[model samples]
Target: MFQLGKTIVSEDIIEKEFVCNLSACKGACCIEGDAGAPLEENEAKILDDIYSKVKPFLRPEGIKAIEQQGTWIKSDFGELETPLINDAECAYVIFDKKGTALCAIEEAYNKGIVDWKKPVSCHLYPVRVKDFSEFASVNYHKWEICDDACTLGKELQVPIYKFVKEALIRKFGQHWYAELEKVAEKNN
Candidate 1:
């Protein structure tokens, strides 16, 4: 359903239709840390620096949320992975007394005290990046697209894509972007 230039995501890509049904579903993708994604070295550093600078301002609830969800651990492959969650929401996510889910990082960013944004893993849901080792590449797809009744499957997933792409470009410079373009072209 998300089409930008030649980037076309057809419904066939969906393996299941996830209805989101946030009221009951708990928005696991947003909160759960270790589904399967891992951060690149550059990404990890940027995230660490930004959060480190903002940590002091984080509310006590924010600290509790992070601790409850579990922190990132270094993988054998050297990537940072949050503990995989099967059903629990992310630790940093808190529901208001009214039951609306809240993002702690979004709160910090909105306060104007810190610009700490969501990490790439959090931004890109179904799509994930894996190092080629031989050469860098950008792999984009709707891996988690579902067919059941998920509103998100019919909605746009590209903003997340753009955010992830932009962050990687900013972190690694232009060559990385060029490689991404190449990978995209080859895949399409």
Candidate 2:
């Protein structure tokens, strides 16, 4: 692991490759996860604020879950997450014509209905961040469901850092990402 500013980043972020192959995985990450998408403290409020706008884009099951459970729910572990449908698919999930799950919140964002792009956690998939008083731990999440993504990323030569560049910049600042790039360059 290496430190970039206050964040402790895992070496796997640079060593591993992963590009979401939606066709191969059919966005199983959205549908098959036991827990809902992780949400930041503020994201829950945003969901409540934008629920009406995002509701139209979601499936009936998702809408029902949100209405019954509220926009976000506290997990047994005390982390905030989107509510789930039957403890399976995320409540904010909407399927594309190709039957791949997508984020309705993001669909609203793309249509300019909401300014916040889904949750930062969803945006930074395959990379989970845990915050502490002094710093944050950033680690690559190795999931069997993403094996096809790993293979495709290897084929395309896209490292995890590169694939999640925008998210890193969003969570950390641009300067932090620049420093991380320097570290990656030196390591490579």
Candidate 3:
């Protein structure tokens, strides 16, 4: 097994263990960070189409990220740089009456207008297309792993398996499914 921060990659990376460190530390990934991933031309087209439809639901501040960065660009690592909202929070986050943040995309999915699919970046936190990229390797922001006073121990579980699994499937499709299945089987 290979452990990188809170992520534990058993013999194969696809079966990597991801435990949410939010309970142990403030959600640094969502609170103060930046993340970028490459988009194949087709993926870019799909994102442009979907984001256009969901644009209105995003806060003006959130929209600024898209405006300033553009939806896609060439990244330093040869991957495409996809803009993310402030601190990488889902563009869909909104405050409740009690002032707690809520995910708008999740809400839309619940309302049936959109499906459970989120942008690839959100689905693959801490990991990105670059992880699979032949030409690039993304470096996602990770503060939880760096926090000195974090409560989670060496073996703590991160609540990201299902989310990551869905994202990997969504981004890589069937070919990777078999590869990941092998990883899961060998590790589990």
lDDT of each: 0.48, 0.93, 0.52
Highest TM-score, which number? 2
The TM-score, computed over Cα atoms with residue i paired to residue i, of candidate 3 is 0.57
Candidates arranged by TM-score, highest first: 2, 3, 1
The reply for model 2, stretches above 4 Å from the true place, is none
Query: Which lDDT tens digits does candidate 1 get at residues 1-188?
Result: 43423333332223222323455544545554444346656655554556655555544655564455444546566667543334345434556566656555556677775565666655544444454545333343443322222455345443333434555555456674565455445555
State the local distance difference test value for candidate 3: 0.52
Give each model a TM-score: 0.51, 0.98, 0.57
Backbone steric clashes in candidate 1, count: 9
Q: What stretches of model 1 exceed 4 Å from their correct place?
A: 1-24, 32-37, 52-71, 82-89, 97-101, 135-188
In lDDT terms, how accurate is model 1? 0.48
Clash list (residue pairs), candidate 1:
16-146, 16-147, 17-146, 17-147, 17-148, 18-150, 19-150, 31-90, 65-91
Once fitted onto the true fold, the runs of candidate 3 whose alpha carbons sit more than 4 angstroms away are: 1-16, 21-27, 35-40, 67-69, 72-78, 84-106, 131-163
User: Which candidate would rank higher by lDDT, 2 or 3?
Assistant: 2
Among all candidates shown, the one with the greatest lDDT: 2
lDDT of 2 by residue, 50-169 (tens): 999999998999999999999999999999999999999999989989999899999999999889998999999999999999999999999999999999999999999999999999
